[model samples]
Target: MPDIVDDKSEQCIRFLLDCLDAHRKQHAGDDAPPPPFFLGLNGVQGSGKSTLVSLLKNKLESEPHNLSTAILSIDDFYLPHSAQQALAASHPQNPLVQHRGQPSTHDISLLKSTFNSLKTRHPVALPCYDKSAFAGQGDRTPETTWTRVNGPDQRSIDIIIFEGWCVGFRSLSAVQLESKWSAAVGANMKPAYAGRLGKLELESVTLVNEALRQYDEVTDMLDAFVLIDAEDTQYVYAWRLEQEAALRRERGSGMTDEQVVSFVNGYYPAYELYTEALRRGIFPGVEGRQLVFELGKDRRVKDVKKI
Candidate 1:
């Protein structure tokens, strides 16, 4: 594949094209073949996965091959707020469950079942998770999930780009907290659960680890993986803050900036772990990791590393 750093917009397009070609070659002999091409773009918040996928889609649309493509965001799989609230009610001390983007916050089984069905050319319904409301909305949910409809003349879906913050991490065994008080170290602590803080801490770690493991498993199902490395955690932190602010503003909410910061901070430890793991060569499957695209202080792509 072409280098992701040199003209990322173009390189991402070329990568998609190459993936499509590879998929065709891989199942050349099969008459009723299943969908074979899938790509996973894993990165932290504000790491440019969405932008890269958009560029790829535009590039493919302009091509002459008539290739059908779709971008599936893992964010859409987040559990509804009602479900999360139920979990929080039962495990009152575990703050991680209260946060929306953590591992346990998603409907993993549904995601797996949908992807599995899509792989076999079956239609699958995909839920649309709303980040602003921290829930799933009805109208936005995919009614007839994109399927690989094969025909002699019409082109089937040539590439499916699955991108998300925690796409490639796998779930580990659950880690139970020793006490609830220990869990209140992070922000967004409620007084009601202060007594069981130690238990919360253990549950939070367990939740974080399990989320990472689930991400890894999701990525494992992809044919290829890409990581958009930010300049540093600080860059991502700024971007996330801006995003959350914009979201609150658009929603016409009365939440103050401090509240937003606090909520965002609650996720810092979890995201930091993800960033550190990627930086430390913990994710071994990314083909060519590109760090710091043109978006921040040190915006130029600097290194080309293999995972």
Candidate 2:
């Protein structure tokens, strides 16, 4: 949340404001009631998704309008660490722990319910997930919980920004190269010293296919989709490392860099595959589709192409 104008986050905020302005103008003469705008912002880990949302909220709050806005992150829906630990124990040999950032780890029902309630202009309780503890903190809820203002003079919510690493990603079947089985075995074996483990591969592709269908439902509700295209997987990896380092320092865990890298590796394959699809134009969310910005390696606009 630094007030650095040069940062990509600042640019993202400006873009969102421009969109809101256009929306207001387009509906200026319409007698039809204006619907609440939902902006979906997606990016890879450490791609400034949360920072951009915070900046957008600040910008909106400063503007004089009855316009109420809320920012929701998919991270808030992460399964508690205890739930994750149970899964790991059940399938000790499986790489589900590494699947933390993947679609399989999110509670789709909770997300769908939250969105449904928000659309109705009702007060909705948003969950808060703790990153360090890998569980829900049960406090520190969203500042502007969705609520309908009373009276005919009440101003309606003009915008809602739903941002997350995989917000717009369509869940697909887990595609594991046969070559990766050996590597999976090696990684899963390390935890045997702590408890008995079972050898399980990635979740069946059918589950992934079903998850993608759920993602489709979420996207179908979006008014606009913004993708934060990372330069490459290497860039995302570096950003994640920096974040993890800061997190470990704050917790005083004294974890070595090697240990952190090893832990992060578990979630790397899924992220790499998903981002590769974006680069190759095969991403279901962006194949010849609209995008808010085409971000590049230098964190500058590489091109402003319409989706």
Model 2: how far residue 86 lies from native, Å: 4.5
Candidates' C-alpha lDDT: 0.58, 0.58
User: lDDT score of model 1?
Assistant: 0.58
Report how far off residue 224 is in candidate 2 (Å). Answer: 1.2
Off by over 4 Å in 1: 1-7, 29-31, 134-155, 171-200, 211-216, 244-256, 279-298
Q: RMSD, each candidate, Å?
A: 6.8, 6.6
- Candidate 2 local lDDT, 27-123, one digit each (tens): 7887865566788887666666676677677777665544577777888776656565665576555554434565666777878877876666655
**TM-score: model 1 vs. ground truth:** 0.72
Q: In candidate 1, residue 117 scores what lDDT?
A: 58
Per-residue error (Å), model 1, residue 33 = 4.0
TM-score computed on alpha carbons, candidate 2: 0.69
